[model samples]
Target chain A: MPKTIEEINAKIKAGKAVVVNAEEVIGIVREKGIARSAVDIDVVTTGTFAPMCSSGIYFNIGHSKPRIKLEAARTYLNDVPAYSGFAAIDIMLGATALPESDPRNKIHPGDFNYGGGHVIEELVSGKDVCLSAATYGTDCYPRKKLETWINIRDLNDAVLYNFRNAYQNYNVAVNVSDKTIYTYLGILKPRMGNAVYCCAGQLSPLLNDPWYKTIGIGTRVFLGGGSGYIAWPGTQFNPSVPRTEAGIPKRGAATLSLIGDLKNMQPRWLRGVSMQGYGVSLSVGVGIPIPVLNEEILAHTAVTDDDIPATIIDYSRDYPQNLPDVLGEVTYAQLRSGRIRFNNRDIPTASLSSYSRALEIANILKEWMNQGAFLLSQPVTPLPGIESGLAFKPLNYRPVERNNSS
Target chain B: MKVSRKIVLHFPARLVEEAIAYRLVKEYNLQFNILKASIIPDSEGFIVLELTGEQEDYDRGVRFLTKIGVNIEALSQNVVRNEDKCTHCGACLTVCPTGAFEIEPGTRRVLFMHDRCIACSMCLKACPPRAMELHF
Candidate 1:
């Protein structure tokens, strides 16, 4: 019998909802089969904790006594620069934004220890951050220089508004060159000494809800240890990638843009990450609930790590040059085994994503639903899926028109 | 009683050129294995090594180094892994020369084995959260 989201909500409200995490759902489906499991389970929760670089936070820094226009000012939070293109006291700090003085690989594999991600983590942890700004004086707003300590509670509103996060799948990074390479995937040893992949496999959000069946805009989620919502299909949300028989993408595919209040977020779930040679990024924890409304959704939740394939990419050559080359393909199950056979050589593998944390988040979300503290919401509008023909295009370089004024 | 101690020796600028390993072997009958060393001529330097010998000889070897102005400390004291900070993401597993990190079979949890760690400090930079810290 097919169920609607309304029916699922009723079960959740009345404490009759059968909620299980993505990991547990796999076993249940194998035991009872999808047909029977679909009726037994009401929701399957998914989670992922990894360094999502395309993430940021925005806030309204209440007006000062003399009102300095932040839009025209250069503002820095704890030495990391931020975007102040909005109102006088509005600011948006990206997770990867580095300070002007950051060497940034100038010394070859530079140490980018702190950035906007660290500032955001500190703010969420209730630490006071140094807010400094310099601007040209205006008649209405005379204060040109401002320096203050700002806490999360002091701000009128602090929001985590990431543009792209929770990637459906990603590549396994390796280095084929003679020398080692430092990348966001961590250090890739020379000659494919090691491989690095970032994903929670069966526990990942989009992997469980492949094709965006139940995960869409307005979908409630467990973000940064707090409740958040899916704002829209994430940036570069391409659904045209090659897929497996079960409809899961074989490469990096769907993503989600999320929005949540930062005040109640926990530091453990929102951590600042520093990769050698690579700039800082935020390790965000995102959990999505899949309403088991039908057998199809239950079958999707039953997909295991062996069914998910990841493309192996050479970071030293193919990646930096934007070359369309794939070294090999391996399954998440092989990756999690700690060793992968690539080019007849046994290479150790590591993951940037924490599977344990992802499991923890999924369990927490499941508990929330079982306790009737959380309810599933139907998508206001579905994301562009495979039928939409949405294609992800790269930037084409062109000469800038320097003398437009002439 | 035989004893093996992994220690770090800080050599002063003048003592940088001293054949300390030779002295430990020839004079104190201690077998020394240099794990790592960073020394530049006429500059302060340090060497990490494992010294094994009779307990009495090991104590005398340490006293002799101390008498010669060689600052000695345990190798484990220099490298530290903060349990609270470690998200156990396994970034350090591949980069480490010695297999200091092992993923538990079922849980997939990364366990940091400090005993096998040579204090290479490779994990310090590779760790996203900077969980693996080096004090010295």
Candidate 2:
């Protein structure tokens, strides 16, 4: 029977509905095609657990005794800069933020043991971390300095409000330089020695909903072992990135801004990562359920790793800005198979992302849906499409003057 | 019987000129795959090798090396890395399920905890320098 949104919600509320993951949706499509799969399956859960560098956590630490207006305050959570630009106790800690203890990437090559992500992980694991802050004392508010230990419980409100979480697609990283490079890409061997990529391809939420028709504000998602929502379009959400005929991005494209409760998170999915020369980052595990409302939705949900091809780039060069030429394209299946052959050259592929954890999160979301603890939400507004291009703002006097007038 | 073991064969400066591997194969009917070797003349030399042979022949080869004062020792780790070659790129961190490969903070160096490793062998090929090796 073709199920309506209301009908599906009713079944879910009553504890009766059949939910298949993105991986399972393919077999259903092959057997019954998109038409029947849409009617039969209530929901198609998609998951991706990758090391998302453009991430952070926001915290409302409540009023301290004597409540100082801490405008110039400098805050550090376990030595990681948790700089909150706001007037009071709200603080934001970026995932890639490194501790001030390290002067530079000077520790040793590639052994960055701790950073903001590690602090977040430790807090999520119920471990206490030192919280210290200093600010000039005001006439009314006397306290100038504060130092204490805090865990997830001490905060009045601790939310993982990541400005960027799930990337729709990402590039494979390789080194073409003379020396091996340590990057957030997890150490690139020069001369394209080893290739590493992160993403679950077809199983990713944005891929299944390529146009972001079902992923937007209020679209409930499973984030790092907890429920979250797509708060806004992520930073560098270039829907304008060139795409293949299959609608997959030829380069990096759409991304999402996610928000979830830090208290509800688990340490297993929120892992701390460090690159030798690079700083630290958090590996966030996210699972989003895509409801199969029609044949289009079902068809996209059935997309496989082989069907999606993301680009491989040379990380040895200055990236995102001064990016080098694209090496070539390869499918997720080929990359995940531990080897990829492109441009007549055989390259071994490694992933900073975890496919196992992605699967585990998908299963958890499926169970959450089954138990009626979670519900799929229709997007209030669909995101921009391929026609919407993104361009850099040129720092020219005339062009800038023109923009300022407008 | 076929056997594979990582044994370090040490040679004094005087024995550096000798063809020890050729002699072992010819005398004991054993096979050797040299994993690492640096036999500099007039200096203490060592060769890390995987020697495979019949049970009796393997025992006899060990005795022969000992008699020649070529110190032979076994490795506790099957999957070992050459520190000189390890650039600590952290490529192995992606495949490790047990969190065995850790990057120390402040220094940003890769720390390997052999106990937590499940021996998936994913790092063997992912490593760029070929620093990672598996004896077993």
Candidate 3:
């Protein structure tokens, strides 16, 4: 029988629960089998530290004297534009948001010293940011403009409300074109000499719970070194991708929208990243606890690097127009070997994800659970696992027919 | 043995106009590539070149130069990366000709093998955080 949430909580408080990280539990289950391990282990922890481009933070800055209820406003944080989509002083700054001075669209990489990512890291590190905003004067609150410096302490609700984070799987990028291409995939060597993949592999949360059995709404997590929770199903949560017999997606699939506090986060786990020739992104550290509700959950945690494999893609083929070709499928163990063979030669690989940081986050969560400071919460709702995929309708521009009488 | 070495060839002030490069290849059968040369205009002269040739011919070429009072010294400048400042972003990985920078499987930290480094100094510019430094 599966252990109840109350039982797990009481066991944690009494310091009698068996909690092991996903990587460690895999070894234990391999020796004892899932049937035996499920009855023994109470929870499994999974972690990852990767650059998240679709991330942002919202802050409610303190009001300046005279209460600027300005009709229109523009603002910037560390040279990057912070969208003024909210009331008076609340703003949301995205990781990839660039300065107005930059002339880059989505295709070209802009050469800039700092971006939104740096501003977020500076705030987490307790550094002040140069905040500048201009507004048109209003009748009730007549403040035309304001420029000052502010830190995390000066904000009321400095919450990291990232819309998307933690991909289930990612593509291994390489350059087949003659010219070196700069992308979020990092700089790829010409003719596929080097390939880069970003993921914690065995330690990734979504990979651990591939089917979303035990991970869902209300699940408490370690986000950016602070305690956080999953807000909703992440944008682009495509569960319709082809899967292995183990149910893990062979390509990029599920993602999680996360919300956390800026005050509790640490600068060490939150670093600013700039992909040369590309845009800026934030390195987010996240860890989620998977409750061992039954033997099924144990089976998921038992999955290791050898059990998970992803295809190597030639990114030079404009994804939709030409479609990326699968060079070959290799297990995570082989990918982590530092080199993999494709065609006739061995190509060196680099990871955009930090394996060391992932391990650190996992261990930190283990200590928290063992000390009874953290408790497991049953998911309020299970994630969608529909077999069908979502689609968009095409535009129609045909002329109206009037039986040739008009 | 066939070998390549970065050497500085010191020339006497009077030999500044001598065709030493042509004589080394034609007379001594030495294969050389000039890396740097600053024959001071009408003054003391010197040239830096990577010399490669057969063991006997290399010996003969060195002897010929030394007999004429031309000094030679191996270049010693190298690339150094500060572990404390390196963020291990791996931007320097692609530009390295000798594969000196590699990721450790266990920690995912970029490992710098000084022995494999050729001191090309390409990584010095590729590094975003400016962690790489050239030491002479």
Candidate 4:
């Protein structure tokens, strides 16, 4: 039988309910060895363009010319806290374009064009929230970095607590290029054909040394910056790659891979594939320790620019095209011969940042489990209705302005 | 005018038949009453729960369960939809614990009723085609 609301309230007020100290709960998680659980990260991106202005509107009609023109920008960012055995995060990056080629400099007269950026607000904890910048370098703003700390043992609790607290400080920095405003009929107009670029990246890094080794983990290389171009009309220019400190080309085609001990890997458990819409796909995989599956070991491998033919005998493979028949035949022969264990299909490359985040979260959770500080909480309600696999959401970080001039 | 809040306590479906649910009620001296106690199958497996009490009581009840090694999460009212990218695989059908999905007879596409969804995310893991997504 359901207790009356009044009675429940009275019990709560009387302190008769079970209340465990936060530290005690942490201790319980550590003792339970729940940190060995692996964390998976996923990322996604969507893009849209600013609509073209009507010819009559640009020329100004007989009645009254509009002064300010507004464009509708449709974008969304989704972040879901860890509910069950898994947690997910999602973010959407978007922008508007200002063209350089136009007969009548209607919009703004400036040497450089303009593009819009996105801002993300996250709820970190029940009481404390933090906002991080989601956008990188652009004409108006410098490149921004986002950072987050996860409590591995109590991942579910920590995530929910952090999300609520982190969201309170949400603010995104907008870029405004210095351009002369041109007006017609007392209204300012933006130049036609000007374009803006928007991009998103996924980062998931497997921290378990054993897992890393099993999957052939490689060195952590930072891919430099680049603007993302939508494959739609009204795009003023092609996406430009951001430069790196080593003067390496920031943008271009690239291939990455993980190689390690394949003997003890659980290929069947690996699931799904996703990619960054704007930039090169950042793909990652980790190997499980042989003796203890809970222990993850980072692997060592090399990602080359050369288009190497897929090796049929490898434990797992990810490629953009079909493998050579010889390699495929060899791989099949090896599988039948018990030379390799390949249970899952090929997983495509994903966003580098999203993969990195997932790895980081997984590693932290593992550590917490090792310390017996992690615990799995039951859900009060069922999971969400949508079927999109657990998507990884990025942390939104913004820059804080310092009043140095004072 | 004063606003009154109710709290509810929920137990997992697996523990419903066991004495644990009753023990929790007796030990805690909880005023909350069990609403629905049953075992339900989800994508991950089976889960049991006992829904009892008001909103405030619910929050307190979660804390109480947390003390006993049971986890609790709040439910939000949000409708999620997949854009045109969905490939229409039937993976989501098996994951819906509440029987929220129905097949459109003509198209054979899966139709979703948000009201019945418990949001356990079993279908997301079961999907092989990389379609089917959740909206905020």
DockQ values, each candidate: 0.70, 0.14, 0.21, 0.03
Count of backbone collisions in candidate 2: 12
Per prediction, fnat is 0.82, 0.09, 0.14, 0.05
TM-scores for candidates 1 onward, in order: 0.90, 0.82, 0.81, 0.19
Q: Which portions of model 4 show Cα errors greater than 4 Å?
A: A1-321, A324-406, B1-18, B21-74, B77-79, B82-102, B113-116, B121-136
lDDT of 3 by residue, A319-364 (tens): 4245646777777777778777888888887777767778788889
In CAPRI terms, model 2 is classed as incorrect
What lDDT is reached at residue A245 by model 4?
32
Cα lDDT of model 1 by residue, A5-122, tens digit? 9999999999999999999998898889889999999899999999999999999988899889887889999889988989788999999999999989999898889998889899
Error of 3 at A226 (Å): 0.5
- Candidate 3 vs candidate 4, DockQ winner: 3
* Error in Å for residue B81 of model 3: 5.0
The local distance difference test score of each candidate is: 0.92, 0.76, 0.79, 0.24
lDDT of each residue in A1-406, candidate 4, tens digit only: 2222244224334544222211122233344433421111011011111111110000111111212111111111122111111111222212112222312234333211112111101111111222122333334333333323321222222110000000000011111123312111011112211111111111111111101222121221111111111111111111122222322212211111212121121211111222111111111122111111121210111111111111221111211222222223111112111123223332111011122223233343334334433322222232211131322233366889999999
Sorted by DockQ, highest first, which candidate order results? 1, 3, 2, 4
lDDT of 1 by residue, B1-136 (tens): 9999899999999999988889999999999877778999999999888899999999999999999999998976557889878887888889888787999877778998766778878888889999888876
The better-scoring model by TM-score among 1 and 2 is 1
Q: What TM-score is obtained for chain B in each of the predicted models?
A: 0.67, 0.59, 0.62, 0.43
